[model samples]
Target: MDRIRKIFLVSINNIRKWATNPRIYVLFILITMFLWSSIRPILSFSKEMGIRVTPWVFPHLASSFVGQLILMLGVVLLFCDAPFIDEGQPYFLIRSGRYTWGMGQVFYIMMGMTIYLLIVNFISILILMPNIFLSTGWGKILGTLAENHGESVNEIEYISKKILLSYTPLKAFVLSFILEWCAGTALALLMFVINICLNRAAGATIASLIILLDYAIYSNFPSVKFFYFSPVSLSKLILIDSKGISNYPSNEYAYIFFIITIIVLSIISVLSVRRKDIQVQPAV
Candidate 1:
């Protein structure tokens, strides 16, 4: 129990130090650019039509393939400095024991990813503050855009019709958030494991290569077999057909794939931290 508390303390301290982290600002800047492009179109459509929207705009903003791609890349930048270690970390690790320290690093990944995703969602809502409202439905313009968005609608504005037909606004938003969190956490873990087992440069590089590879393979291949191994695809609900007859993997399969991958990577992370000589260099 005391060890658990110590681990939590380490994780919390890491979170607190995020104020000193430059990457956090860079992440927000990236997110704002991506989100502004996404939300601006919706806001424009709403103003032209004079119709208020539901609070579920975030899902649509993140629904497109391009949005997801940028998001994956941004998350890579967000946690690029995985294991979040500095010169001060070595002394702390000595006091906390590598086992507790390793677990704390894992906790940091979980917390950090959660914060990243929540910021995305919050900014989406914030952008649409006056124009959007709390509602169970996808609202006027979103509903139309989802099903039969005419030529008048900008190409930048998008929400999958399959999403509207298959799930409610709340469900779509909830699922998108959950899936992104899972995939982002998985990527962070991959970086963490590699950073501990190998070197920092290799860790970030390999994780990025995997992401680019995943996007290329899935984008080009588009096969059910491929989805079984792809991390980013699991975040895409549009790929999953409601009838279960499409080529995409089912929801159940995506969850299992993510859970298994995260668990295995997390186990490796703990083991690596405990057994490996994880050297920390001074922050420059």
Candidate 2:
């Protein structure tokens, strides 16, 4: 119990240190502003067309191309300087058990990513407040699609409408938020593992590339889409309707895969850190 408390306190201190860093907060706000600006035009167009928008629309937009670009960049920037890269690591490496230190780093990444998502999502809700309406089901929004059966709608719009119709507005919001959190956690853990094996820059670059590649492959090859492990896959898994309307894999399976991946990556990171020689210079 005492050891756990000590580790918790150490992790909290690390989180506080990170919280004091201006760059992370600055990047977070900038990303939020960029997302808001990008979505403003869409909201305006929706209003012009007399389309009833819901709060759930923002998550769909945030997961779009522009939104994904900003999100991936923000994540890379925010975590590119993980604790493993800090200078004078030998001194601190022995101060705490490697496992504890690794756990602290994990906690730090989780907290940072949570804050980033919350801020971005909060800003999105605020921007769409005027058009935001809580609906019990998708019947309200899908009416737009029904009215324009001949019009060609994009896959994103189709999926978003299906999600909104299948789930209540509040349920959609909570599910979307949970999916984002899970994806962020998985991504952060993966990057940390990469940082353990390679340098921070390489980790960040490769992590971002993995996400892009996953998206590209999933977009082009619908059959093998489920094989890739990326935030895009996680998001898509969450957006799948209960009736298998999207023809995607079940959420239960995807979630289980995410859990397994996180556990495997976390164990690998901890083991690597434990065996790593502290005599070498820091990567930072």
Candidates' TM-scores? Answer: 0.94, 0.78
| Residue range 1-284, candidate 2, lDDT tens digits | 85566567555665565566687678867876786665565456457667765555545554455566677677777777654444544444567777777766676677777777887877876786776565655433444542443143432242344554466756666666666666667777777777667767778888788668656765786675454455555655233545655556556756777778767877777777777653353433
Q: Which prediction has the highest lDDT against the true structure? A: 1
For residues 234-281, write the lDDT of model 1, one tens digit per residue: 778876554688767788877888889889998899898888887766
Q: Going through the candidates in order, what is the number of backbone clashes in each? A: 0, 1
Which pairs of residues collide in model 2?
138-165
Q: Best candidate per TM-score, number?
A: 1
